[model samples]
Target: MTRVQANLLLLVIALIWGSAFVAQAQGMGVIGPMMFTGIRFLVGALVVAPLAWREWQQLNAQQRAPGRREAGKITALGVLMLMGAAMQQIGIVHTSVTNAGFLTALYVPLVPVLGIFFHRHWPHWSVWPGGLACLVGAFLLSGASSLQIGVGDAWVIASALPWAVHVLMVGRVADKMAAPFCVASGQFFVTGLMALLWALAFEPATLQAVQAAAWPILYTGVMSVGVAFTAQVVAQRYAHAADAAIILSSETVFAALFGYWMMGERLSPSGLAGCSLIFISMTLIQLIPVLKRRYS
Candidate 1:
């Protein structure tokens, strides 16, 4: 896919993720965070498993081998994914919603910085300003008057590191393997299996709890984890990792919109301004590279 098309797919994924925030939130009320995360992603894995098998069938003899190094990378990616998901689920409980929202956006800038520092990959210049703007906008959109450090806040902050790494790794693995569905399925299963183990060890899981959270679990599993994450893996093949981060960060904007519509949450003037800046910044990031290609 073209970069633009890939980015548009990321935008759609953001929308789905944003809308699922309510489901995620409600899910936490009745289910343990680990249990909810484990079940949802396990469902997602099952949903995508058939497609992964199909992709496996088409691979040549060499590609089908599941090299040890590649398997290690995929396993690490799954651990990162589980870490990100589990942290956010746990963190949002003790922190203010605004704090959680603002802190989660930290990954936008972290993606490129990590790439540059470790992977020796430099992002386009526009990514710098655009990413910072998105960060600021996320802060504003979060509606936080002051930054406070708390247990939940710290968890949320920590989540950003794994999330940023996961994004970078996803692009690298997809590029190396050229099998998006397989990567997606493998990560989902790994994440789910690990999370379930954690849940069983620490959290109480019962049929009643699962039934109470069933809709939220099913929606998030099928739509957010299964479809959206899979598409993200596919799209990241063509989209720059840094640029994709900026686009995916628009999930906070979508979250606000969904909150307003479904939960009667209202956006203030500052929130609206933050939303505008986010839109403008994303546009600039996406447009600059296109312009460079066209004019150069």
Candidate 2:
């Protein structure tokens, strides 16, 4: 695929992911967040398992890297994913899809900062300014005074660190031992199981509730997790990494658009400004590395 084609594919994936936020929000009306997340991820795991099995068989045929399947890394990645997914799902129940989408993108700025602790290397000076922008933007989005913020926005913001950790964890293990599909399946299964435990402990989910949420659950699990994720993996093989990131970042824009169209959601002028700042931060984060490499 050409870079243009790959970017277009990435945009499609973004659209799917963005639309999935609506699915998530709608699902919350019928089922508890933990129950919805658990079933959604379990569906995703089922959808991806055959693909992982196929990838494993291909690796065996090609005698590629050891199919050792790093259990430890997968477990850690799953834990991070579970945290991120749970927070996002719960936040969506109280927050607008637009808020959830933009706030979730805060992880872009947080990723480089989080690397300091994990990789022991500080990020570029530009990253700090970007981080500041994210904070201001989030404040605007949350409609918060100096001291007060919305509970839903708080959950979305809290999810950012876990999302960053999940991204870093993936980087740390990307080339190590597991197949991509296998890792994805493992993450989904682990997250589903963990969320199930949480649901069992706190939220009550009946078969009727699950049945009521069936459509939204399937949409997120199948389209967002299985198809869109797989499409991203394939498209990135042919696209520039920076281009891929930028294209994928449009997921936030699409989320806002969908929220408005499907959910009649609207933000104040300050909130829109917040979204723009967060987007600017994400763009700078993606671009600064390439600019440095090009100039130096």
Alpha-carbon runs more than 4 Å astray in model 2 = 1-14, 62-69, 87-106, 120-126, 149-158, 229-252, 284-296
Give lDDT tens digits, candidate 1, residues 1-296: 89899999999999999999889889989989899989999999999999888877777555564567877888899999988978987898899888998999999999999999878999999999999999999988987889989999999999999999988879779778888888898899999999999999999889999999999999999999999999999999999889999999999899889999999999988899899899999999998888999999
Q: Name the top lDDT candidate.
A: 1
Minimal lDDT window, size 10, model 2 = 238-247
Q: RMSD in angstroms, all models?
A: 1.5, 4.3
Query: What TM-score does candidate 2 reach?
Result: 0.76
N/CA/C clash count, model 1: 0
lDDT of each: 0.91, 0.74
Residue range with the least summed lDDT across 10 consecutive positions in model 1: 59-68
Question: Any residue pairs clashing in model 1, and if so which?
Answer: none
Model 2 residue 107 CA deviation in Å: 3.7
TM-score leader: 1
lDDT of 2 by residue, 1-296 (tens): 67567667877998998899799878988888888888888898899999888977887788873333576677777898889988877787787765775677677666666677677866667666766676677657655544424899799889978877765556346445546786778777888899989999999878998899999999998999788765665565565443444446556667776988999988778878877986787567556776898999
